[model samples]
Target: MSEAFGSVLWLIVAIGILVTFHEFGHFWVARRCGVKVLRFSVGFGKPLWSRKDRHGTEFAIAAIPLGGYVKMLDEAEYEVPAAQLGQAFNRKPIWQRIAIVAAGPIANLILCVALLWVMFLIGKPDYSATLGPTQGLAAQAGLRDGDRLERIDGRSTETAMDALQVLMLAAIDHRDVAIQASDANGHEVQRKLALSRLPADFDQQNLEKAIGLVWHFQVAPATVGTVTPDSASAGLLQSGDQITAIDGQAVRYWNDIAPLVKQWGERGGEAMVEVDRQGERLALLMQPRQQLNPDTKQQAWVLGITPAPRKAPEHDALRRYGPLEAIPAAFRQTGRMASDSLAMMRRMLTGEASAKSISGAITIAQVANATAQQGPATFIFFLALLSLSLAILNLLPIPVLDGGHLLYYLIELVKGSPLSERSMVAGQYIGLALLAGLMGLAFYNDILRLVT
Candidate 1:
């Protein structure tokens, strides 16, 4: 299937599953509380398909699949029969009402753990937490080649991803952190990473570059994959050509090309570009093409050649757990993700983190498609993250959300009554306005990412 179609389809499937679990939480709880559910729907708006359950609740699939709700019998919303007065939600005790409203987010949180458990049951392959020769911040921090990272800020880092994640988060917050590593002699070493030394204009797209940490096995050979049509290297460079030098500068790895390209592209001169093509060395003098770089949005010179796709090397790390062991692992993983997510949100509110991190449907769809393509384990991990996000977002103290309703109930419990209709209505408008602004910002960030 086309990528776009696949993205949209997977997004729908994911949202459907998450929403069903959320709404079912309320449905199950409400039923157990003896409250009559008028309808249980997995989506909003007009019902596409529906059936009446034995308990008289109409279960439905709606046309708009973005959100769903459980309609409970309430005296405030509809006239109730005298015989069914006890079944009206408004007549229930304040504690039961609170439980009913809180159930959705709680359900999402539970789903996150369950999904993570399944993911752990299926192993995840990862790169070793080994680095090449360090430079800049890393070198200054006393890290070096052959050192394997063991922990960052006391959290174990078994894979490259684990180390990168911790480092990136610390970099973004401009926080110095302690790292523990093992040297070639198997001796433990401790170092403090001065992330504060990071340049204000560092490459945001490549957080690792600013930290000067390179994966040991990720350095690909300088083999040409494809040359962009009509560019400087179009006719001169061929596939499988190994670039040996650019403008008389030695090029040993794919990562070595960009700096040289920029250096020559800025000097405004035709330079000798040497390549080994089928064991014959060929040299071509060509002026590096100059154009605006989309990512950095600055004028940059380029050869317009892409590196060949590398084959998957042997995995140096794996995260797998037995069925029983996965339970606690899932819980721990979920807690960490939840904590990090909350911390990031807090930082964003205080302007300590970039608001550019916000993303919309486009980003979500793309990520869903990518993870699904990778494998079931990765897809399950994505779902767990997404599910946790759903839970936390719903728990926000905004009117019309689960947390907002819980807040109202709590207030009622304290004041011995519900708020006035006018107050509740105003709160809803304010909540909608806040949610709308966040959505707009997320969309803007997503579009910005696509273009740049």
Candidate 2:
């Protein structure tokens, strides 16, 4: 219950920020275009809180918090007195109207970039672009464990996330992706990853497993950090015990000890663990516990101990940029995100991708909560990602959306007249229906995911 409540609260805070910026875009541009803004609302339905500005505009916080709008004086929606006719939205030039309508999504895009800029300055925790044990086709392609990924198809990859993004796109396109990697001895090697064998309907959820891209490189010691109370290792293992061997087998890292523990649990055997406690070597006999994996719903071995801290290499540390240097980096990152989002949408629409890729409020709330727990940097990145998504979603050429409004304005510009009222209303109905269906599908996916 507490977790659910925290998710809900974080979701509200995140949505409030995005909605405020979206509406502010319209409000700012409308005022600049000399349009009389009547109301600036963060959400729909009756206003929960409202205050009339000096210019007679009502600033409000409404009951609903999912979305918001900026209401302007338009002759089509309401009567404008003769004295205020010049400030009416309907009376503005087509270009000004287009600008006013475009500003909301544009603001979202700008916010995404701005957030990324700040994020770059603050830096992000990242694992090295190194590979663990490779299996399947990747291994056959000569990609080996401990090979540090340098570049994918000419794009420099500093982290696993960067490599995954490029690899996912390559898989979706069914193309051979060129990769440059450095072996453990710092020897550079080249390889090509074939993606033609992937199913046409591959989605984000299982992409990593499908592509065999695992980031479990051995970079940390196998030292016990904590022991869960009342568990199998409760009294047998203590924190700060560096495991040197298990069952007479040398344990070089946590990876080495993990499989041994699992092997012991599978046969219900005891493990003879040799640990270095301070300057003394201690021998302990411990039995592994059988626990269910929450994610995969499979039974697995558990040691009830957390790994000690491991410091990454300086070169593999988080990337930080100065203010001036971060500008172009943020621009490139945002542009790439926009392109990837558009490509994914295109694939989904073309039946090449699964609709399960679409996430609703529940999934988003859970993600928000998870990222919030990670730290401020991760939460900021999450906001940027969601903001960019909002920008792209609103820019789609559908009615009732900013993109839809722009589409109508474009038609008006091209045809030299506004669309007929009946046609406009019909388009609006179609757009609303499409949006409703999309939302319903997203909600269904979210519920389905929650259950299974």
Best by lDDT: 1
Residue range 1-452, candidate 1, lDDT tens digits: 99999999899989999999999999999998999999999888999999997889999999998879899999889799999999999999999999998999999999999999999899876678988767888999999877999999999888887787787778877789999999878899999999988876566558778888887777787899999999998889999999999988888778889989999877887899999999999998887888888999988888889999987667777789999999999999998889888988897898766788888999999999998987898899889999999999999999989999998998898999999999999999999999999999999999999998
In candidate 2, what residue range of length 10 has the lowest lDDT sum?
310-319
Go through the candidates in order and give each one's C-alpha lDDT. Answer: 0.89, 0.87
Off by over 4 Å in 2: 199-204, 217-316
Q: Name every residue pair that clashes in candidate 1.
A: none
Worst 10 residues of 1 by lDDT: 199-208
Clashing residue pairs in candidate 2 are: none
Reference-based TM-score of each model: 0.82, 0.83
